[model samples]
Target: MEGQLDHHPTPLGNWLEDLFAKLFYQPDDEICKKAMKEEMSPQLKVCINGQHVPREGFDQVITEARRTYNISVQNSRELLASPDATDKGIGSVAHIQTFTLEDKKTGNQRKQTSLTISVIAFSDGGKQLIELVEIVLDH
Candidate 1:
């Protein structure tokens, strides 16, 4: 489905947007680390391009991102939500992200890639903690 940015009225939507903002735009590693530790569940699962990424590898991912690419988040919006009978809910968020590869030695910008990311988030504990995150990249 095509993704559009809009103000989502639900609490879960607000939280998801805030998470994305801190993760993609904010450059502070400490803030990012705290957010991950506080917002993610102990059994959190993350996937990218249909491949599962170990929880322990998340720090590496962030480090790689900071070292390898200059990222800009064009937009992030909530697409849909599926709430269970309890407080758990699953939300789909769309992110328009642009990544430009950086040359390590020359500090030159290399290839630029713009993609839409469909993020599926499984939220529990009153939608405060994310238990699962599946990211699908669209070119």
Candidate 2:
């Protein structure tokens, strides 16, 4: 029971753009996950620092993210506005997201916590899946 990005028959470009803003950049993992499954193609792939991670489905990405940080995902989400233009698909989105990681064992909050601006790429679909995400770290 899926619908096109232009389910209302508006416009792909504008509809897709706004859909991404709510899903990928939202402050809720549940919301993002739901949108990812709907928008992203089965052939989704991701690259980090020029290193490609093969067959990285949406679910795996979230699982790996939690493991890599060494802290439980407390409340981490993004708020994106719009993106520029790109060759592949939609350009990278400009967003501001907040993340708080808590120690897994002791449940202690990390000292280093801040909000940041990030760029996110989206796929062309009704759901608008995030193809790539790059965050500008704050010192």
Candidate 3:
């Protein structure tokens, strides 16, 4: 089941994770936000802990994140195990990542905020972007 992550490496998941890991180590907020913009679907929706955010979108999330912290993502990795079938078609990928975040001003921080993201991909031509859910599974 967990081996499933390797299956989607060609479609962009690995690249995205690597980008996040790099952003986590960098100090530039704008660059991190730019990278996120490249990864997001135009109309993104995220479901975290059962609370649904409709059309909350990637831009909004980035804006909010920037407002809250210096915004760094660390220790990003993917977890894939036993994917189940889904109706929208790109199938489903189960992946988890851990990152440490620090406050912008105080430099206060927390370690090991693990997240499990469920992604669905859609294509126009040969390009793909994640079109579905992302969430936090570890606190």
lDDT ranking, high to low: 1, 3, 2
Cα lDDT of model 3 by residue, 80-135, tens digit: 52242222334444555666556777888765554555454554332233544555
RMSD of every candidate to native, in Å, equals 5.1, 10.6, 5.3
Q: How well does candidate 1 match the true structure in TM-score terms?
A: 0.61
Candidate 2: residue 86 lDDT (0-100): 31
lDDT value, residue 102 of candidate 3: 68
> Candidate 1, which segments miss by more than 4 Å at Cα?
1-9, 84-129, 133-138
In candidate 1, list every pair of residues with a backbone clash. Answer: none
| Candidate No. with top lDDT | 1
* lDDT tens readout by residue for model 1, 1-139: 3574444435555666576556545778777777777676656666665677787786578667766655555544444444531144445433333444455557776443332333335545433443445444434
Ranking by TM-score: 1, 3, 2
Query: Which candidate number has the best TM-score?
Result: 1
Cα-based lDDT at residue 94, candidate 3:
50
Q: Would you list the clashing residue pairs of candidate 2?
A: 5-126, 25-78
Overall local distance difference test of candidate 3: 0.52
